[model samples]
Target: MENFIYKITPSKLNGTVNVSGAKNSALRLLAASILTDRDVTLENNPNELLDVKIHVEMLEALGKNISIEADRILIKDESFNNELVWNKRSIRNTVLIAGALFARSGYASVPLPGGCQLGDRKIDIHLDIFEKFGAKINFETGETNDTLMLTKETELVGQDIHLPIRSTGATENSILIGSLAKGTTRIFNPHVRPEVLDLLDLVSKMGAKVEVFGQDYIQITGIGGQSTPITPIVHEVVPDNVEAITWLMMAIVNKSKMEIKNFPYAHLVVPMQFLLEGNSGISFDEASQTLSVDGKNATSFEIATGPYPGINSDMHPIFAAYGTFAMSNSVVTELRFFDRFQYLEEMAKLGANIVQDKNTITISGNIKVKSETVRATDLRGGMAVLMLLNEGTDTATITEAFQIERGYNNFVTKFNALGGKLEKVFPESTKEINVTKEALVA
Candidate 1:
């Protein structure tokens, strides 16, 4: 909608909510499914969000037969020979597809990918690894047509590659290609998101030699082809840390308490520890995978967003929302997504005292939100606005909510179920609401 309002009423969130599958892991695993020529079934998968649906469509275009029922995806025609083609407009999942196509057909050519406008997420690391595995990449500088050609030696010959940074996407790409390469591929300075490990686990189950060496290294020995068809396996997607954090921040900002069920404790350790540092009372029971946040009087603290096991970049916007009601200043330094501070402007519209620099957001505590229309800059940013709106501000009109729909399935519905008053107002209807002087006077 051009402009839409969510009329949230202040309410206590006391019940439990189960977390869905990890979107990050599912994207990689879905790409990895193309590695086999047999029927590959992924269990514990979450609902098909926009990115997943787009990836599936891209695969289907490349001649992969796919079927979805419930939380499972059955991918047959594992003999992935055709080039994975996609609309030049849809490049969000291209990197993941690159790994899968490289593993399956020994070559892949697709346009450069797209996603959040978080500055240059250089594919240098990915391309460097692919080149080390002997793939020729040709980038058309002026044009959108980019090509990656894999040769006879296209099969990745496993070798020790050290990463300068611990990028999750690069690490997963390396693992996927390494699984089908000729020798053992050892990656150092790698990211160990449990979701990435889950994909490795799946590849290992498919007769690949994959192992996690402590927290920094992953070793994978090449297995040339799928030994057998992937049997339908039940894989419960890990709970989304960002989602849990969003709800938790909402609870705190609203001066309400909530018990989040299926909360991924391990994945959220860093953020939870940070929240606790901010004086937000939180209790966790690992056995039940539940986290309870009693945020009746939550304070604010500084946070630096980092990679996994650190304050994640994805959780920064939610943290920003929580900062609005904190008793003290909250400094959020986004170390990963340097340019993600654009959301601060939207937060400012809600009367949040926020200032942005190159990579840091200095948030002054104690904001009194005013009803205003704001636009979602990105996925997490959209969720942040939604969380802030839940505290019953006069009325908040948010645009670009479609960005939220990209990652979250029926988000407004879920929030509504929790007593949030939000209605999906289309742009056409909003056009008729011209503020007249008489209406304002009344």
Candidate 2:
């Protein structure tokens, strides 16, 4: 099968969705596990997602002994050879592995990382910080690919480093390398994402001296300490604010009531405000980490994506889907990922009046969609298309759903459990070329 179709029925959606662990945070934490000489265990980690699973596979391939039980993972960094280079397939997790390798071996050579096509994610900040800690870097860039060679001279000497931006990857790299430096290392303009803090906590647990002074400054005292085996501790992962926003938008689009459990309300302040501006009634229960949505009279709204504590670029695609059902026009300005508007073409096929200008998208209200085939350009785009299929259209076929499977574990099974009619089909069987013109004439 070349494509999969979702046969959806418009009905009231009820029940609780227990949010999964933070994929972003778990990936970094898994990298931190390699810093310990003894066995380290991580709880509430995202081991189910394909990205995380592949990272785990890479770790195992590099000769790390690991085991998983429930939401906890036990990783023993008994023996690892930094000489075991990573291929293109293994480079996807380079951001996390870079920090881990630097912490353990005092040197690392990671090829340029790969991720969604969100623009140029340069490594200048990472390299600058690494250099400040007495590491020299060599770059090998070609027409289609690049690799990095990092080496340390003597013990890394810590120094105060300032970053041009609050890049999460840069901050993580600094923390990982700085922890092993000889003196005090101070990082200014640091990113304060919860995921970064989680990594700091993990490093501190491994006997590293770390302190956060303010919003964008962190100080770490470098002093090598003994490594001890630590087992996984059970700590519930924070709910995905992006996914919660997607579900909330779904409720608003359908003008139906929805109660989202295990939602990280604090992390969704911006999205909540956006919903409020649309006149969608919302209530949150902090104790239960649940968000209730009542959109009987939902209106339209406008938003622009920003960094943390703002409308995230990651949520822009789903916002497009929800905007289609608004009572009035809605605009989503993607300030972060400039090329994200391409997915609107798929929405257009579903009869959504979406117009794109550079990084902005204007969505007309109340699109009457018809069943059609669409292709997911990326992970978030796939989810956006899936949400659009929830209503409006009778049957929508989606291609390149493998991108969605990379981030969402057993997505079809989960959607089916929620009464969503979706079937996965192979690409070859469902997609055909060169037959459309002849078939159309017939």
Candidate 3:
């Protein structure tokens, strides 16, 4: 297992930090590539991310020929095995892969999805979507309900699916399956975020007709069984808005004036406006897609997580850390994932006065955080703990630090560039060898 040892010595940070391509966008975009047999190229892909690596492994298992160079990935369908029958780490995006596989091949058998342990993050909705698309689903007979098998006895035909809530994964699966299914598919109440739009852009380029009527609904015209295969084209992924906000929060808490390059301003208009309301001196350069942070301290405020154009649940922990630095009180409610309060207990070790009642959490701020060992329960929560390591000189250990790497590309390198004293420690090593900050810098 990997852990991060942080020696806090807060100092003024300088330099331009380049943001990587969006992890959420890249993962699904890779899955959408499985919808066609033609070659596809993805530029600006975050190939260094752990999640992206796992996704690549999954793609290879499906017999896709993938070549990665720098941040670009070229995928070619070679000998695709529709049945993903193997054992390895799995991500929630497997559901999307399943949808794509079902679209291309009439059957798919995949391992269950696994990612952050957010409560009630089930794929039942996804299964329902598959059923609506006329696929018969059942748990693999030999597996311990850890694998899902989907078989389409007849041709896949699209249907009108009205999602109960705005679900990003469900919406993405609908788009992927509908890309090649017969007839036009209509999806209602879809979560229209930058990542979803990124998938839409790629599928549309592949010859799927996708129409978005505001946030109300999306319609896709499938070209299944067409003589011409889905067009082979190159697509560039959008910048990661989550990583953009991570850098922004790092600037705010460390009181460092820095520039975050490749910042996706348009995708974060709502959240950026909200941060500006809290007295953050952040400026965006549209031409350069960079964010200039004046290193002003963030003020206490309240926010609720919702679908895009609103603060997302992934931003909850980052915002919680921002609130911890404010002199006043702040409250954050997790409207999407109710049991995402696992990070609150970990943040409390850093001297944050946070009290949780159901989905709402109240944080009292301005208290100096002490260096203490904590756990990175999830991706964003782990980064939040790192953001709070501003006051202590003692080493703070964050166990399962790999969680942080699963999302952010070269995060340790980026943080060290911003004057953060962080190092990764491998516990199995005889000498407790650390991937030193100097090594990363060099």
Best by lDDT: 3
Among residues 3 or more apart in sequence or in different chains, the pairs in candidate 3 whose N, CA or C atoms overlap within 3 Å are none
Residue pairs with colliding backbones in model 2 are 1-426, 1-427, 2-426, 2-427, 2-430
Q: State the lDDT of candidate 3 residue by residue for 1-442, as single tens digits.
A: 1344433444456678999999999999999989888899999999999889989988998899999999999999898799886555667788888899988988999877777878787788999999888899988543322678889877788789999989999999999999898889999999999999999998888887889998999999887776654557899999999999888877877778899999998888777865786555788888988789887777888888888899878999999998888889999988988988788888889898998989999989886887888888788888888788655557677877777898999887887887777777666542332332121210
Q: Candidate 1: give the clashing pairs.
A: 37-78, 43-235, 44-235
Q: What is candidate 2's CA lDDT for residue 420? A: 57
Candidate 2 — worst ten consecutive residues by lDDT sum? 433-442
> Which candidate would rank higher by lDDT, 2 or 3?
3
Q: What does the lDDT read for residue 198 in candidate 3?
A: 92
Q: Per-residue lDDT for 1-442 in model 1, tens only?
A: 1234344444456555666677777788778877776566776566556667767777787778988887778877744555755434454457768777866676676656666767667778887888887777665432333444544354457868788899888888888888887778999999888778888887886668887876779998878643654465434466677777777777777656678788888877777776777544778888998888777655777889777788878888888888878888888888886777767788877778887877887888877776677887777888787776666446567775656766775566666666667777666656433322121110
Sort order, lDDT high to low: 3, 1, 2
lDDT for 339 (candidate 3): 80
State how far residue 186 of model 2 sits from its true place (Å): 1.8
On the 0 to 100 scale, the lDDT of residue 118 in model 2 is 54
- Model 3 segments more than 4 A misplaced: 1-11, 141-145, 229-231, 278-280, 429-442
Best-to-worst order by TM-score is: 3, 1, 2
TM, every model: 0.89, 0.87, 0.93
